[model samples]
Target: MNLLLLKLTLIPTIVALVTLAIRKWGGKIGGLIGSMPWVAGAILLFFILEQGKAFGIQSIQGSMTGIMALITFCLSYAIFARKFTWLPTLLIAYVLYTLTAVVFDYLRLNLMLSYVLVLSYVVLTLYLFPSPTAPPADGRRLPFDIPIRMGVATLFVLIITGLAHVLGPNWSGILTPFPILTSVLAIFSHTLQGSNAAIVTLRGLVMGLLGFTTFLYLQAHWLPEFSVATSFGMAVVINAFINVVVGKIW
Candidate 1:
């Protein structure tokens, strides 16, 4: 119960802060930060605390597979953003995400293989995605925007974590990176700043996933041997280093 309350409070707070940071730094930096394991890391932490390291490892593997879905989501959104408004674009992208998730769920691959596949897809999508042609405009801020985002993020954490028990580690892992935060950010950016802004945001997200992939890779390899504190600490350090490299390259 105490942990549950902590999750409900902590995750949204982090998200709100990140969202504000995005507003301050602009989409590329914000998207890169947003791409960190904020949501999935939190979920896996709770999985370790409640279900044990074995469960966490299994979920991590599942999450690797799930990255394919995230790639699909980004690609779909980027493509459709060219021709459609945010609403229809989001709807269509979501449909693609769902289908991709289902397909990836049934077709399991080893972690290294999954990583290779996902990384390859990311590269292809990045190449194929059209540059945003829309003129830049400042996004309109609603007083309620941050609050709504906070509420929705918190709610998603609750629901996704609760469902993990029923879905088991693999399916839960696949669901871990469901693009909730990305969806919110993309929608708001599209509405306010235009399609190009949203495209930049998604591109940043894909780049940031390099750090995310490293975090999970370390956790999967190290968590079984080390204490959770030690394993997670090392993973964060490595992930931060990789993010720095990515930031430099980007």
Candidate 2:
């Protein structure tokens, strides 16, 4: 339990403080940290509050609710920072999920699948849907840094989660999706480095994804039908491989 809370809060909090002390901190750090554990703990607590227990691995319905709540709370914080825009976003997701949780007794499977389907939509939005209001990464040219950092973070979390899945069937069935990893990473990167486009962020994203793709292909079997040759081939396409070809083009 102590370890869980440390993983959940103290680490991020301390890292954030260190960045601040070192005069490296920039962008929306405070709001980022403020929203994290509060939101996650809220959703986890919500289930415990309503159901009297943690959402077990087998409870797809509960798991999905927690995921959706997380998604809603997360974006809501990052985007609005306590403003009008936040309310509509929160209300819509909350109302929709509320309907599912309350009025729709007949469509449990449908609700869970819908939330999972929304998962990709949210991620693609991370890449495709540019933020209306960005964190104040002042004087920083590396706008692409944070998102790439997020991609890297997601790759790491996915790799670890995949390992857990293989090692622990009982745990796998519980399916505690760390979908917010990318978001959290983006927030942290901005807080730490002042801009997400730090060369490190891009490098980390490309390397991490490539590493995970290899792990998935060689040992983990994440995409069962995807051949190893095909996987590495795509990784090569990220223009990162061009550095190998063009030699120091950046």
Candidate 3:
């Protein structure tokens, strides 16, 4: 019950912060902040407490797979956003993400291999990602936008964590980074701002995935040897460092 309350409070709060940050800072920095593992990290913490460290550690492979699919989702959405409205663009990109997730899961690559491949894929996808054609137009804000974002994010967390026992580690991990936040950001940006805004936001998200992927990768090794808090803390610092450097260069 306590955990449930935490999920209800924490996930929405983080989503609200990310949404407001994007509004204040624009898509790139906001997307970078969104890319952090707040949702996934919280979910992993719950898995560790409920399922055990092994369950959490084993789940990293699936999270890596999910990250790859997330990259595809971002890239595809950015590419399609130029030509279509939010609905068709989101659907097409979602299909691509599902297909990518399935293929990666079937291969069942080792952790290190999956890690390397995903990092490589991130770079390649960024290169292939559509360049922004124009700035987001001045679009009207909708009522209860933040509340809606919060509701969707909280619901996603509830579903994933509630089903942890049933999904087990691998499937849980795959679903961990399942593009819920990405979808919200993309759809909202597309609707409220414009396709260019959505594209920029996704590109920023792909860039931030550098740190996000590393955060998940380290957990595989760290979770077994260190306290959960310590492991997550160190991973976050490293994740921040990677994002700092990548943000400067990319």
Q: Which ten residues in a row have the lowest lDDT in candidate 3?
A: 131-140
Residues 1-250 of candidate 1: C-alpha lDDT, one tens digit per residue: 6988889788888889889988888877898889888888898888887777799899987897777888788878978887889999999988999898888777878888887777778777777876877645788887789888888888887888888789899988887888888888888888888888889889888878877887887888898899988988888888778777877876
Best by TM-score: 3
Write down the lDDT that model 1 would get. 0.84
Off by over 4 Å in 1: none
Error of 1 at 64 (Å): 1.2
Error of 3 at 227 (Å): 0.6
Q: Number of clashes in every candidate structure?
A: 0, 4, 0
Alpha carbon RMSD to native, model 2: 12.6
lDDT of 3 by residue, 1-250 (tens): 6887888888899999999899898988888888889888888888888889999999999999999999999999998888899999999999999999999999999999999999999999889988778887776789999999899988988899889999989999999999888899999999988888998889889998999999999999988889999999999999888887887887
Alpha-carbon local distance difference test for all models: 0.84, 0.35, 0.90
Candidates by TM-score, descending order? 3, 1, 2
Error of 2 at 232 (Å): 26
Error of 2 at 162 (Å): 28
RMSD, one per candidate, in order: 1.5, 12.6, 1.0
